[model samples]
Target: MTPFRTLTAEQIASLEALGNTAEDWSQVRVSEDFQPFQLQQSRLEGEVRIGSEARIIHSRVRNCQIGEGSLIEDVTALECRHRSSFGNGVGVATMNECGGRTVRIFDTMSAQMAYVMALYRHRPQTLAALERMIDRRVEERQSEIGRVGRNCRIVGARFLREVCIGDEVRIDGASLLENATLCDGVEIGVDVKACDLIAAEGARIGNGSTVERCFVGESCILDKGFTAAESLFFANSHCENGEAASIFAGPYTVSHHKSSLLIAGMFSFFNAGSGSNQSNHLFKSGAVHQSVHLRGCKFASGAYIMSPALEGAFTMVMGHHSYHHDTSALPYSYLIEKEGRSHLMPGANLASYGAVRDIEKWPARDHRKLKRDVIDFDEYNPYVTQAMLDAVNILHTLQEQDPDAEVYTYNKTLIRAASLQRGLKLYNKAIVAALGSMLDRGESNPRHNGAGRWIDAAGQYITRQAMREILDAVDRGELTDPTAVDNRFRIFDVHYDDYAHSWALQVYASLLGHTPTVGELNDAIQAGRNAHAALREMTDADRRRDCSLDMAVGYGLDCDNEEDRRRDYFAVRGLK
Candidate 1:
């Protein structure tokens, strides 16, 4: 820390002449190279320390330490009344609004940490240990004086109290920001009203949004009048013109529609279409129920569901559903309401062009400067393959039980006979293709052991045993803080490919009932290639529907002839 010197007699006179007033001249301190002329029409009170080249113009700064090259211009009031942690230790009641699921928000909180905190209540001792680690992190942030870091520009802001601004941040035209930690490189834009919030590095909270008790992750964007309270939003999430309450939104969760309300749910890699909604209260009890939509799930326009439900990965939900079905064992499927009944088309999304597009685009769309959360972008990882494996067996059993039935019921969702047959084949094909891809990686030996149940931790795929070991380390008092836990997660990320290979080998051995010979392995590889080609062909055909003649109806509205319409349509929607 650079030493601060009391303002000189001449410097005080110069500041007074420029309409700057200090409560006590002795209490005001400045850096060795501080320029008195830089401050204009500002009131400094209660131990203000100004760094070199920092300018406080037309602002009221109280009990604050302004860093080098920082400009606090055209502000109303900036004050720290008491010792503040700047939104650290603020508990966000995520997943359950009425209580029972709350995550402590801190400056360095990652998605994986929050995931364990909110969802691992079954392990009470582990949750207690994790909470202690977070408490220690929050204690480190407590300070009597608020700080504005180097090169930050807070312009046209009104009423900022107990806010800790980090390096290179830009706060413009914000209104009533209180008790918030704006991390390094954060941008707070026009008319944002935030309280008890932690905006992580490279995050932007702008466009008249209202956020309270929220932990905005790195590179996440919340804008366009988005209102959120008691929510935990993770890396790369984008929300605009929507409302989110009590939601544990994992990485890449997006809700852009004006009429969407995502509440009391755990979601990751999800997209909420226009008017998407979910109800957690059935009126029998206070709002206590919660829902889970796994990775790559999408809710179509006007989609609604009651809580106490679980959706599978890459499942597309449409219409209203209140039956509270669990489709977790059926990945890449469609759950749509047809004729007032829930219809489940298991593994139907495998042939969807949109599903393939989503998997391809997530990695490219990540905007985080430092990706602390580990993300496995493989669409057919061990977690998803396990779901597919279960789906195949379930389909086979259903077919055997009712050979002539037109519709089969499972988990209160109806599946047509033809849809079941097609889904079984699709699931089998996907399993073979995924196994072949894993075999081609050439991993003879793996470092991390992957056995037992697999889970998708936000975006990363890992064995449940590995997650439990991390918790055990925490409970044993070895991993003392959040940083130590993050380092372990990083190590897991580094060895992800090797772990996946080991798990795939186990799956292969289980299928063959013994170690595969060289000839058998070669045959399996060829069969996987064929299945992959077939699945790809189906998705390609689905893509062709985008350029069909019916879809081009609005493209050439003013065209007089069919030839002119064709030319215009081809110009806008080119054949790709």
Candidate 2:
């Protein structure tokens, strides 16, 4: 620890001349290398300490101690007290309000933004304890500056009254920060202003951003004219060039468009396109409009959705729709609009090579390097596919009950007669494909011991005893919580071999009233695999046909041939 020192009476007087007024001279303290001439008019109350070879200019301080080898230049410290200790080579810039009142600057340490929110907003008792801890460090010279970790820099900040700044932080050209805690390695860019905000570690706020009453999570980025009010953004998310109000953005959420506005809703891993917007109220009596977009969802450009709609996982939506459609039962499907009418196409994406490609790409798309505070999501979930299979059964039942019923007439949407017939065939094919894929992959696993176990009375290849064990584990409040869920997924991600097949066997057993023999189970698995592979090939072929060269003929107006049309398109673009 460095030794203690005090400023001379002449230095105290000089500080007073520079717009600083101290209630008592004996209360002021400085390092041995402190110069009286550099001191400005500043009020020193209780006990104040300045660092060795440090500069104190134009600031009012009360009940705080400055650390040795630190600089307090042109900064006001009011009622601003630090009971904590600061490491060597720290710097602080402060300014006083118009009424000549002082502000408190506390020690720095990084915590999750959500944790800070819970601390300050939800648990006031906890914050009071932390504040008291800071207040108690006034007397001891060894406890002066808050000891932050190495290579931290804070510059050009007008810290308002009552703020908590964390260690290893960097703030540059920040204006009007009040009632906030900035966690470790947080970088606040130029002209960035925030109030009542908490920024987690490794988070970045770009230049000219404004945030109010928000919690920004770890490794999240908000830059280039982003503005958020009363929002909570979780880990590994990115929001840029947009405005958000009263929104909760979950993990891996991304919105990067100037005209996009996310308001009063919940979203995760959501991609909002340019001009994409949602209506929270339809000139209603109150503010009771909200929409939910589950994980792995995409919104096309210029898409507009009204409230009270629930879209399922891995669903792609295109065109504008005002109707409240509930497609939660259908996963990995496409909902398109034709002539102002919503059209439901079941299993439209099932055979598409793009769907498979997307599944393969999501795991590799992880950009977060730091460990997250919240649970990481599984982009591909067997549970979701199982739900889809259940939906297929329900839709099949509906068709058999009314062969003449319009397939698309659900929640004010229309399904053509042809579409209905095709949808059922496609859904069945998808179910078979999924089951086959599971069995084939499982058989290749090293854990496979010559066809594994025999079927139980419940018609499951895995015994009812095993099924009950798995369900009981989930029901015993073991997998419901976030931590448990995350741990389970982490293990599943690494060693999910044969798990999908096991789940399939369970589903098949549930569907069949009687248990099948081992040979029958193996035969079913092989048939399912072949059907799935054939469907995938068909889906890929359809995609190719959709992308034919002749499809661009109408797209390029007034062009004679395909070659001329292509040249015209490129030539028009080259002019720019």
TM-score winner among the candidates? 1
Model 2 agreement with the true structure over 364-465: per-residue lDDT tens digits: 655545554434233222555565675676567667778887554765556566765666677677676666556555533444222223211100123233
Query: All candidates' lDDT scores?
Result: 0.91, 0.57
lDDT by residue (1-576, candidate 1, tens digit) is 867998889999999999999888898889999888889999998989998899999999999999999999999988888999999999999999986899989998888888889889999998888888878878889988999999999999999999999999999999988999999999999999999999999999999999999999999999999999999998999999999999999999999999899999999999999999999999998899999999999999999999989999999999999999899999999999999888999999999999999999999999888887778898757899889999999999999998999999999799999999999988999999888776655465655777678898877787898898898999899998898988888788787777777777788989999988778777777777888898899999998886777787777789889988888888888753
RMSD of 1: 1.2
Q: After superposition, how far is residue 31 of candidate 2 from its true place, in Å?
A: 10
**Predicted structure with the largest lDDT when compared to the true one:** 1
What's the number of clashes in each of the models? 0, 30
Q: What lDDT does model 1 reach?
A: 0.91
Which residue pairs does candidate 1 place in steric collision? none
Per-prediction CA RMSD (Å): 1.2, 10.5
